[model samples]
Target: MGSLLLLTRIGGRPAAFRAEDIGSIVELTEIAPVPRAPDFVAGLTGLRSRALTVIDSRKALALPGTPDPPDVRAPVVEVGGHAYALLVDRVDDVVAAEGEPTPPPATLGPAWARVACGMIETAAGPAVLIDVAALVAGPHRAAA
Candidate 1:
């Protein structure tokens, strides 16, 4: 079943993470840091017994790195068989795709844009339909 995505602001920019990817929205807790990982990797948190990685989705998108505003929250999403919190300013309403998924844009630059399957129009405008799995856990990261 094709469901809607909940919009949110990632570092002042608008973005959306599919509701389906989200296991649940949770309150912030103790997020411990891990060593020798990507800067985009926010850290890890314990959910019951499982350790979930928290990613600054904004940072991951190659946006300017800004210290996460404390007020911002995250959705624990199951990505690459592991959990990661996509930090967003706020979670907005869920809405359906207005029409068929659009193919990748020819003029779209930037490396990550390739991972975006396409765009889907919504009430506000078009939201990038990200291929989460590919977006995450992709080719091994070169050294930092």
Candidate 2:
């Protein structure tokens, strides 16, 4: 079966997440820092009175640091019964996934390969589909 996908810019590269995996898309706001949190954890923000942990997409993808543009947004996604705000560069559009996703390319590198579920073709080109669970848990989780 196929599903809708939300295209987004993560670390200046195009990526996607299953639309069903997301709860809401919100504008970038003040995020309270969490002392001693992992580097990839962008910190925390609140939406509708609920606290949300924000994951820095660029850091998670091992990309060079770039300032968050004015339009940056966080897509609230739930995994393992907890919610996380994925701090992406921008939220593009929602599109219907054409077919089943194929395995991510080996050249995607370690950081991306760890969280990428697969790749799918979109009108804008191919986008690596992100695995929300792996992203939220992050790479260090396995070592801990």
Candidate 3:
């Protein structure tokens, strides 16, 4: 069976999320800063009538520095019954995931490896498959 994947760019690096994991792709226009929140937490935004907490994809991937202004888009996903908006550099395209899943590269380092399910080859190239649940669980778990 073929699986669909949503391709995205986080900190300029290629990444993919299972299509089923994404709730919606939205353009982030306003983000209200949450004080005392983790660095990886970008801020919060409203999606429909619900509040969406935005996570900085760059930071979540262990990339350096603060991301620039909210000029890009985000993918809204649910984790632990709560909604999160993933702030990415850009949203690429959705493609069919083909072939067997390969282990994440050792070069991804421990931090990234923990959140990535595996790697898959695509028309664009190999992309790190992000495990949204794991990614979202990281911060909340750490806080406890």
Clashing pairs in 1: none
Kindly list the per-residue Cα lDDT of model 2 for residues 3-121, writing each as its tens digit: 88999887777889999899999886698899999888988888888888888877776678765553567789987777789878788999888888999999998888988999998
TM-score of each model, paired residue for residue:
0.77, 0.90, 0.89
lDDT of 1 by residue, 1-144 (tens): 356786665456445556687688767667787898777777888778888787766566666656445544667777657787666556666777677667767765564474566776778777676666655553345587
Q: Scored by CA lDDT, what does every candidate get?
A: 0.66, 0.83, 0.83
Residues 11-81, candidate 3: write the lDDT tens digits: 66788999999999988889999999877887999988999998887777677754455436789999989
Alpha carbon deviation, residue 36, candidate 3 (Å): 0.9
Kindly give the number of clashing pairs for every candidate. Answer: 0, 0, 0
Model 1 spans with C-alpha error above 4 angstroms: 67-71, 138-144
Worst 10 residues of 2 by lDDT: 135-144
**Candidate 1, run of 10 with poorest lDDT:** 133-142
The residue ranges of model 2 lying beyond 4 angstroms of the native Cα positions read 67-70, 141-144
Clashes of 1: 0
Q: Which regions of candidate 3 deviate over 4 angstroms?
A: 66-71, 138-144
- TM-score-wise, the better of 2 and 3 is 2
